[model samples]
Target: MSYILEILPSLLEGAQLTLKIFLWTVVGSIPLGLIVGLGLTSHFVPLKAILKFYVWLMRGTPLLLQLIFVFYGLPLIGSGALTLQRYDAALFAFILNYTAYFAEIFRGGLQSIDHGQYESAKVLRLSYLQTVRKVITPQVLKIVLPSIGNEVINLVKDSSLVYVIGLGDLLRAGNVATSRDVTLVPLILVGVIYLLMTAVLTFILRKLEQHYSYWK
Candidate 1:
């Protein structure tokens, strides 16, 4: 027990980094995902095609590969023009990868909206922005929240991937402890921490789903 207590602080520090990465990725990806979703569904053929290709490339690749490419490969390609620090590289990869997934989810949500809702918006003399904000956005949010919740849960786990680039995330911290002590307790603690975090997120997401359930 004393050994576990001794290692707890370092593990918490790593957890903090993991949380930061998750929060920033969520903030950066969600809006961009919405924009990309909009672009995918837009009438402009060229723009749609470009976004389609972007989404396909992002989704088709493994995020771990993307992280490696961003952190290790980009610097090689452009003479280091896009060199990012380890932390920044992880965030960049995570946001880009998740944005593609969220974009697809949002696109599906947006498309599922009844076409007559748009016709009604036009008849109401609502501008495009207003129509989207007032009519379409709510429905899309309700539809996509479940998927977004899934992604958010995945993000919590995926933040551990930052350890590959030496970011000292929770899993890495646990690994370090286990290596140093030659014991598995630290890793077990790490698992407990992850389960606690996911449990909280599940509760919050369920409440959100309930709040939005009133729409149906």
Candidate 2:
């Protein structure tokens, strides 16, 4: 117990960074994804083509590779215009990668709405923005919430990938402690912490789903 207590602070610090990354990624990705999702459904050919290609590239590649590219690959080019700090790189990769996924989910949600709803909104003289906000968004939210919850949970685990960029995330902290003390205790604690985070998030997401279930 003494040894565990001694190592707890470092592990907690790492967990804090992990949480930061996860939260920021969720915040940054969702709105951007909504925009991308709208673009995917737009009738404009060029815009749709670009967004589709962007989504494909992001979803097709491993997020680890994206992290490497953002952190390591970009700096190799002669100009420093694209350089990012370790933490920034990790957040950028995570948000961008997850945005692609969320975009697809949102696109599907948006597409699933009945076409007559749009016509009804038009007959009501509702602007496109008003219609989307007042009528379409609630239904889309209920449709996408489950999918978003899955991604958010995945984000918790994926935050560990920041260690590859030398960000000292939860997994790295545990690894450091284990290597230094030659005990698995810190690693076990790290796993427990991750499980706890996911469990809490699960509870919150369930509540959100229940609240939105009225749309059904």
Candidate 3:
């Protein structure tokens, strides 16, 4: 117990980093995903094909490899390649990966909307952007919130993956503790923290789903 307490601060420092990654990834991915989803379903054939290929590439690759390539490989690829800061690199990989996932989720939500709803929006003389904002966006959010929430929880766990590139996230902190003190308790603590974070997110998203259920 004393040993666990001794390492708590360091673990917390790592947890802060984990949280930053989670929050930033969530913020960056959601809108980007929505845009990609829109592109995938758009009338522009070449644009749709390109976006689909991008999605396929992101979804098909291992995230760890993505992280490695962003942080390590890009710097090697060409003379003018931009080397990213460690956190920036992890953030970039995470946003790209999660955006692909969120894009698919949003695509499913957007596609589920009745075509008649769009016709109705047209009847009201709404522009495409206005129609999306006034009619389609609300419906998509209501439908996708639960799924998006699930991904948010997964992001909490996935943030640990950043440690593969030496970013020292929560899981790595626990690992460091165990390696130094030869104790398993830190791992248990980290697990509990992750569970708590997920639970809170679940609760919030459930409420949001209900709030948007006005359409139901």
Ranked candidates (lDDT, high to low)? 2, 1, 3
Off by over 4 Å in 1: none
Question: Candidate 2: lDDT over CA atoms?
Answer: 0.94
What lDDT does each candidate get?
0.93, 0.94, 0.91
Highest lDDT: which candidate? 2
RMSD of each: 0.9, 0.9, 1.1
Worst 10 residues of 3 by lDDT: 74-83
Q: After the best TM-score superposition of candidate 3, give how far the Cα of residue 58 lies from its true spot, in angstroms.
A: 0.6
Candidate 2 lands at a TM-score of 0.98
Estimate, for each residue in 70-188, the C-alpha lDDT of model 2 and write its tens digit: 99999887378889999998999999999999999999999999999999999999999999889988889899999999999999999999888899989999999999989999999
Task: Give per-residue lDDT, candidate 3, residue 58.
Answer: 94
lDDT of 3 by residue, 22-87 (tens): 999999999999999988889999999998998999999999999999999888886447788899
Clashes of each: 0, 0, 0
Query: Of the pair 1 and 2, which is ahead by lDDT?
Result: 2
Task: Please write out the lDDT profile of model 1 over residues 1-216, one tens digit for every residue.
Answer: 899889999999999999999999999999999889988889999999999999999989888889999999999999989899999999999999999999999999999999999999999999999998889988999999999999999999989988778799999999999999999999999999999989999999999999999968
